[model samples]
Target: MQFSIYSKPSRKKAWLLSALAIALLGSCGKAPVQNQKPATEVKKAAEKPAPAQAEAQTGKVVVYQLFTRLFGNSNNTNQPWGTIEQNGVGKFNDINEAALKGIKELGASYVWYTGILHHAVIRDYSAYGISHDDPDVVKGRAGSPYAVKDYYSVNPDLAVDPAKRLEEFQALINRTHAQGLKVIIDIVPNHVARHYQSLHKPEGIEDFGANDDTSVEYKRDNNFYYVVGQPFQVPKPQNGYQPLGGEAHPLSDGKFEETPAKWTGNGSRLAQPDFNDWYETVKVNYGVKPDGSYDFDSLPADYATKSVQQHAAFWQGKDVPNSWLKFRDITFYWLDKGVDGFRFDMAEMVPVEFWSFLNSSIKTKNPNAFLLAEVYNPALYRDYIRLGKMDYLYDKVEMYDSLKLVMQGTGSTDAIASVQQGMADIEHHMLHFLENHDEQRIAAPEFAGDANKAKPAMVVSALISSSPTMLYFGQEVGESGTLDSGFGDPSRTTIFDYAGVPAHQNWLNDGKFDGGKLTEEQKQLREFYVKLMTLSATEAVFNGAYQELHTVNKTTQGYTDKTYAFTRFNDTTKVIVASNFASTATSFALTLPADLLQQWQLSGGDVELKDMLSERKASLKVTGDTASVQIDLAPLESVVLKF
Candidate 1:
């Protein structure tokens, strides 16, 4: 909380100005009508087949994510703690209650909590990144929820009773189910803690492959950041003995290293020092670890052939406690807790086998559970696992690559074409987004840095890609996702911001949505997020199959910018999701297949129509071949047509 970090910008004045401005842009696009039956209204609708018929006819599916724990324990509040100014503002504190309530209201089919269990940590590395000492964050909270200390227990601070956390978690699940939302907790099965009671080994403990019994202290080796460590390794540890270290069961088919020396340690977290003392554990050969620890730790493995064993997440790989599950349990508990699914954290570092296994497991609980990948380039999926599993992954490289080629004023259409070609060539298992947790927010992604144009660009990719779509909070309304890269700032994701309303400020006051720190911009952006999330939860266009209509060129790059327009339609419903990312208004058109036009013009079952966010009816004129309409969108805006 220093005056030095960011020259604290004046928020109050801007707050007053934007509140007034929403009215000018008060385009309350009519939300899709609710065929959704609350528990009370279900009886009458149960006999009526509206919802069921539509579902059966189209085979629709939707994903609703909570983005935090308390969706693990979030609460639903009635008011803001104080006035919008000088008071309890846009923060979510009580996650449990709010999550239960938000699910049904938002209509999320699946609810996901990012981190909810007893998140792990290194003596100090977990909280301090590579530093050996703890960093001064809010109350010295050392690690992100990604770091796991204990797998079985939930975070004590999150619940009223530190001891009965799991019980309370179950209660949260029941409450969520009452609201018709499914829970999905986080699961980290690859690595364990540095000095947990289960895996501590003293300095003199006999080496058993990777110091299986040593207190996890691999700071000297990079491969052990989250791998396991030697107990005496930490300057301060609760136990006199070192913690046991863990590693992936070498699942690769390559030549074995025969010793831990070749495997320095895990460097992905970049949170710890390197280790050269791993004496226990064999890295699989099916895939090579990023650092070449053993092999196949990254590739898809044949679980049936290999004997399975590994710890949970390791904050630091070297000299770290040998108990990381890698990418299994922590996220799994979210699913266990009734969260719908997760936007996988650093998916690339995790082996492809884990995802395949978990995705299948989730089906038993809730087949509709949605899993979106944060992989660098979904196009990389061209290297499909002979038996890999996952619903969708983000295509990071291609998004930036295409943005540079197209919007930056230098690339040819072929440049953009190849990117789409990769999309076309790959299987239909992907989720595309302009931004998510790790990168900078859309309003200020290094490429465009144009707050006004970010939303349109992000939406362009989200709507057109064959993968299921998503809107990271704060993408719309031009809010940035900039993080304090110098220090450990709890993740806000490179995801787009969709919240930009007054309700979030009010919700923050009610004391459930606060995440400790937020600015006025955060509050405004949360409103847009709520609307965007609501749209995703409620619309049919986004949930079903989609195809790009036209506009290979002519869309601008500023406000009123029009990019590719697409349509998500079924026999009974036809929704046009048209977008323009440039500042000047542009017109785009689409022609429906004959089957669609015949059904529409004849049956006129195009009974209902609405825009996703604005909640307004769409304007249109239908002739013989197609229904013609000129959509007017502000730069960085989209129109979701629902029928």
Candidate 2:
């Protein structure tokens, strides 16, 4: 369905005036300008407040994913394959009270400290008795965070004192909590580094695969699935690729010793995995045999709907996989250290039942533990949520993909309505994000190439439902991810190398933790995100019922496919949201269906609608079976109009 809007230059003046007034009032910390109407006009359409059912639901979750290693690295020397000394890494201490307070002010309830765990790196810490990783197995100068080397310790590169790395991380967690934000760290359940060894495991806890029978290909209790007989062979460098750009290093001989090979992290069973495979890591075994049959007890059918406590009870006295127990202990250990939650890496690669056992165990320890997972398959969404007991799954396949297409001007906003409808039953379980460590930055030439293009999309993503909204570090001010930082391709912020995020550094502004060096456009973009995210976290209407106005307004004049509209409301508060993906200013009549008007118990009259973000005002005219509000939106503009 196509939608078009007519030009309305006059409304721009009113909108500017409203925005200026709101900004002036906001500086004084006063309430926004109220609708000036006669008492008779105000009382004409007043109705009873809706029930507090939506309020009874869980509060909205807003996550700010901060790449721990990059968040505070003030050094702008983004030299390719730069060493820690040359590039300079951010320490846990850099995320001080001021930094955390800045994050808190950005409306983040949880700060996902990505890459905090001890991962395989090229840097030698032999003085601290840490074994050096072979450059052939490591992905970059700074290894991939998913190739975790130790579950019990934090990354040494992020510490002011490498000997006290864990202590520094704990201090960071405390600071995060002090700022009213919870902590979330990566839990790579599917794999560990190729040379996995836990030097800091707790007493009486043997390392993974320590007691495994390596002679067999698969064992029910084995920590890793082995390809017996064949010695592990390092993948041959291809496409002219070399470890550390063919740099001279003692361990860069294209050789890694293993008497018997283990499966690759991505489930490649070959002893000589392709260079494209996850060759740096080995997959963890969770009792699923080579033939894909379960080697352990399976949950009953009714267990899908069971509570976390019930799921935990079901696993009691049951013989589960050894890897399951190992992960459980590791996670529990972190919980004891005050981590509030985990972001499981490639969670779908592991079996669902294992998650059921692991996640339930986590909830038993902390009922409010935020369990978010990276499960890309939409087909497995329900199974993971219901059976696996996942608190949140990435809404990438549908919500993120659709919005991205809209931003690129290659897809219609109608697809967004369809996605919301398809996932209506499990909307809250899906987490929304526009940018992350994995995805291309919105400002990258490969993406929309402009940070401003994401403003409307971010508005919809943050306010669409009760699900969590996530903002990657530097997304607020548009880090283009255009740097060729080595190992990984450009367009995605390099998670594999020691490099500084230039745009993020500008906001860092020499550790001031303020956007001191940001341009006016960048500051405005960040302000838009700040307002949207704060409302998402603090507003009840976000967690309320939703109704799509896109389909209903398809045939309406001045309404086009480039514009999307919807409403989220609860017992008391109601908001109409609209976004223009077009590149030009457009004016459209945003219509609220008759059913919604009836549900809201509003009689035919003129209702004032105020833009929550910009403080712009519009009048909703209700006459008989029709209701619509004239809306003027600039290119990539979005509004949250509360009546």
Candidate 3:
């Protein structure tokens, strides 16, 4: 994800130079052994059992998306565009038992370790037998993780020993599972780094473009879409763009030779793509013809309702394309290594047929594997989930965008009901998040502009449906993504540069992984997040039926458009969640309609209600057919009432 909207290039360049210089001081060789103990002993330390095991797998999957390189960094230097040595990179070794435990305490069922895959970066790793990528083809000091270079290996920068990078990642996966948390890594199915090459792939597994007849523009078995007879030409720098800030490099002549040029990652077929295009990567082919026709058979209509086993059976006799088989093999390699799931990037760009074959094959091995895809087209949601066999799709364009409107005080809670109603059939297949690597931070001036203002929205995101909830690392501590890191703007954390997060560093507390350094207000905000996530993970009602109360109360006396309320309950537990999005404190008598009263089997009487978050008690008076509860809410406060 790119974030270049709020940048100050002049100042950022200085910091970038400092970081690069510091990184340059290092010898290009295998790093010193982190610990004198044997490999087995060091592995044991990483797998140390936490004092408290994470809660058992619940209906709700709480995901914590940690940008692995930055999660453990403690340096406060934060010089925008600094080098690895200046900013300090967080190794897989740095995510220790204490760190995992802290994430578990926040109630994450899965830890999405972003940027784990081997990706193209400008870092010089020639000493480790890895070729350094040209800055002309790379996107930042540290390149975008989405532009993956190798599917079989982990990023070498994340490992103490570059040769043992895979082993280090495996240890991390083991630690995550030990904490009762599953692991999710990114799989960029639509494209790969411009210089895609896997030096560490398993034996007999051919590289993506290997054995391809590059003379053809399109082929059923070719892994890439090529522009026949044309050579790839680097786009001239638009918008004052420069290769590595105009730094002189032996290979920085704005030229990359690729005869029969491949199509750009975003499907721009031009030999010279625009600078704003996804020029750092190239699109992967999946048997779709130039006329948008499929070169493969489509899934039968009945497959939507069939079991994953049946789905797998359907593909048994078919001869799938080369790209499909390649990705399937990649998934199996990781699944064999104990990866629990994948967060597929730009999954929709690839044909749904490929997903059917890929996902079915995955489920046949691990039925409980979490398959969340980045699909924003609501019209295609059901098809991807049912026919394509995906487990979840992002609710970004609708729920997330709507919630942002509510949080910004420009929208109504009325839309929340409509959103839920529209997705009633596929509610469980949607995933919700208030902050992620791609979105603007809630505390950033471009977004809510205040972390506290996220409380109400967080409640709606987590408690509104049975869908999984995701939290970006440092979100709880209100890490405003306002740093002007090079190649990226403020308002979103820098995924492209090695920079320390100020607020998150406070919670990291110099690797202690405790909140000892957080201010009182920051601590309180984190506590609120803990309560919210904890309830979502352990509460049975979150997995049960949901009914929006805002629609019924819109015409009520004191209720405003900025307030949203909902009810979730199972056979034995009931929860009423309400949020106030206004600026000042507001009081309202939340009314439960007759249908809800009857659903709860409550006649006309007084029932005690307890606030699950603050542990305060209040009484709900049931009169006639509806129940009314008077509540005083602080601005941006949300309450979860349990009966």
TM-scores, all models, native as reference: 0.57, 0.91, 0.92
lDDT tens readout by residue for model 1, 1-643? 1111211113212322332111111111112222211112111111111110112212222344434422221132212111112111122234455534544443344445545555432222223222221111111122345444444455444445444555665565565555555554554332333322212122222222343322332332222333333112211222221221111222212122221222211222222222211111112111223333332133223432331122112111212111222123334434444455555553544445444444554554456665665445342364322233456655556655565334443443344335665566452465555544444444554445654454545445544544544443334334343432222121233111111222222343444544333456554555555565555545545545555454333333321223556676655567777655555665544444555457556332233457876887755656565555556666556777776
Report the lDDT tens digits of candidate 3 across residue range 1-643.
Answer: 5413333323333333332111111112212222111112111222232322345566588999999989998877777667888788889988998999899888788899999999998888888778879777787778889999999888998999987888888888888778788889999998898888897777668788887788887887898889988998988776787766666878889899778789888777898887766788888888777666677777777888998888887777677778887888788778777888999997777777788889998998788789999876666688889989999998987798888888887888888889999999999989999988888898999888899988999988999999999999989999899997777668888888888888898889988989889989889999999988999988878999998888778887668888889999999988889898889887888899898888889998899999999999888999879789998888888889998
| Candidate 1 Cα RMSD after full superposition onto the native fold (Å) | 15.8
List pairs with backbone clashes in candidate 3. Answer: 3-489, 4-489, 16-81, 19-82, 19-83
Winner by lDDT between candidate 2 and candidate 1? 2
User: Candidate 3 versus the native: TM-score?
Assistant: 0.92
Alpha carbon lDDT at 23, candidate 1:
13
**Candidate lDDT (C-alpha), each:** 0.39, 0.82, 0.82
Give the local distance difference test score of model 3. Answer: 0.82
Give per-model CA RMSD.
Answer: 15.8, 15.2, 9.4
